[model samples]
Target: MKNLDYAYLGPPGTFSEQAISAYCSKYGGKTHACDSIRDIVETIVKDEVDLGLLPLENSLEGSVNLSLDLLYKHSELKLYREIVLPIAHYLLAAPGVKKEDIKKIYSHPQAIAQSGDYINRHLSEAKIVYTDSTAAAAAEALKHDDRAVIGSIRLADIYQLDVLAENLQGDLPNATRFVLAAKADKDFSDKNHLGNNAESQFKTSIICAPEVNRAGVLHEMLGEFAKKEIDLSRIESRPTRQRLGEYLFYIDLMGSSEDPDLIEALNEVEAMSGYFRLLGSYPKTVIK
Candidate 1:
């Protein structure tokens, strides 16, 4: 493959960078940092970048709303793969700044939310300063010895900060799901698979909007997959945006889109739903 360009949400030292590091190791891509998640996605959509490493959901914080909203609205991008990185927040302090010495906590809102219980219990006195990204928070920690940041462990090396306390998340085993997206293929249809890696054990994602919007329409659409013994791994609906109460159901099913059982279920669902979109298929990996 050509040397690919992978854009991520970062300044540096964020979890998205770490996830893309794992990806670039496999795919031989050069990484680029964008100011916002929207920048990353729009660049990928416009072919300014080859791939976008985007955080989709967190084990503790539910969905990353900005990422999800972007994906939902931009149906022209294909989800190339899914990366599940175990999120371990570390409190990085400046030199001589002990746990008790810290008075200000710099963190992304998501990081703050994820570590809320621990903060309330242990370091309740510290003032919270939310930044655009965790790496940005890491930047803040570097300036003040009395301040600390909750960010990636790698930030300690990048910013030369000290790890005051590790494993500060409310849940010790917290993780975030990231998706790699690229400019979508124009001609992809029912017969074709999204990628060669998608030929085996994989997951296919689709967005569905029911035709009639009547009671039980959603239930019946799901029943199509349930009856086929095709397990639905995830099902979440986002607003369709055309009208109030209108919504689109985004689903992840445990098979390739080309799989016979999956094909049958989707066929039934497509007929029942007014709108259906195949958001590509990809293999899933949980990064340790």
Candidate 2:
């Protein structure tokens, strides 16, 4: 694969950093760390990077709404690939600190929530502090022996902290799905070098805004896919923002856009909708 420029969230030790790092290791790319999801998307739109990786969903947190919202807003962006990274939140502290010495805990809200049961069970008395990102929490914890952070194992190494507890998240094998997006015109047909036969395995994503809100209209729109027997991996609605009750439907279906059934079903849905966008058909990445 040709080397490409990539963007992701971080200062280092963030899950986004890990996700993009995995992709770069396989495909060869120069990575740029951005401050937020919006920055990553904007960088791609501005052609500052060849691709940007954004977390789409987590098994524990459900969905990252900002990423979805940006997908809906940016017609120029097309998803080219996806990556699933397993989340392993660790309780980290300065060297020489013990569990009982942790008077305060810091982490991103999602990290804290994923590791909630453990925190409540063992560190209930500690003050919970939320940071903008898990890496930021690790940086904060580096300042004092009394503070601890919940983050990845890499964070402990980056911040020179000790791992007080491993696998603190409530769920075993929790993972987050991340997508690689680029301008719609970017070409990435060179998959043979990456060692994965990509064309055969794909998932198509789309967004549809109904022209009107009527009884059973939503069901009728979905019927097109149901009639074709297309397997939908996800279906969720985000408000249109133009109207209070109106919404745009976001869908992920298991098939390439080239498939006859999927193409026909999407055409039918678009025919009955005022706004429609086929985000992209991307190869399904197997979690390792």
Leading candidate by TM-score? 2
Superposed Cα deviation of residue 116, candidate 2 (Å): 1.6
Q: In model 1, what is the error at residue 230, expressed in angstroms?
A: 1.0
Q: After superposition, how far is residue 64 of candidate 1 from its true place, in Å?
A: 2.9
List model 1 lDDT by residue over 1-288, tens digit each.
346788987777888888877766764678899888888988888888877888777632223677767887887888877878988988898877899988999988878988888899889999999987888888888888789999888889888888888888855457788888887863323222223353446888888899878888999998999998988888888886787889888898898877888899999999988888888777876666
What TM-score, computed on C-alpha atoms, does each candidate reach?
A: 0.90, 0.92
Q: List the residue pairs that clash in candidate 1.
A: none
Off by over 4 Å in 1: 59-63, 186-200
Q: Quote model 1's TM-score.
A: 0.90
Per-residue lDDT of model 2, residues 1-288, tens digit only: 467888888878888887777766775788898987888988998898888888787732223888998888888999888788888889999999999999999998888988989998999999999988888899899899899999888787788999899889766557888888999998777774232754447899999988888889889998999999998988888988878989899899988899999999999999999999999988856445
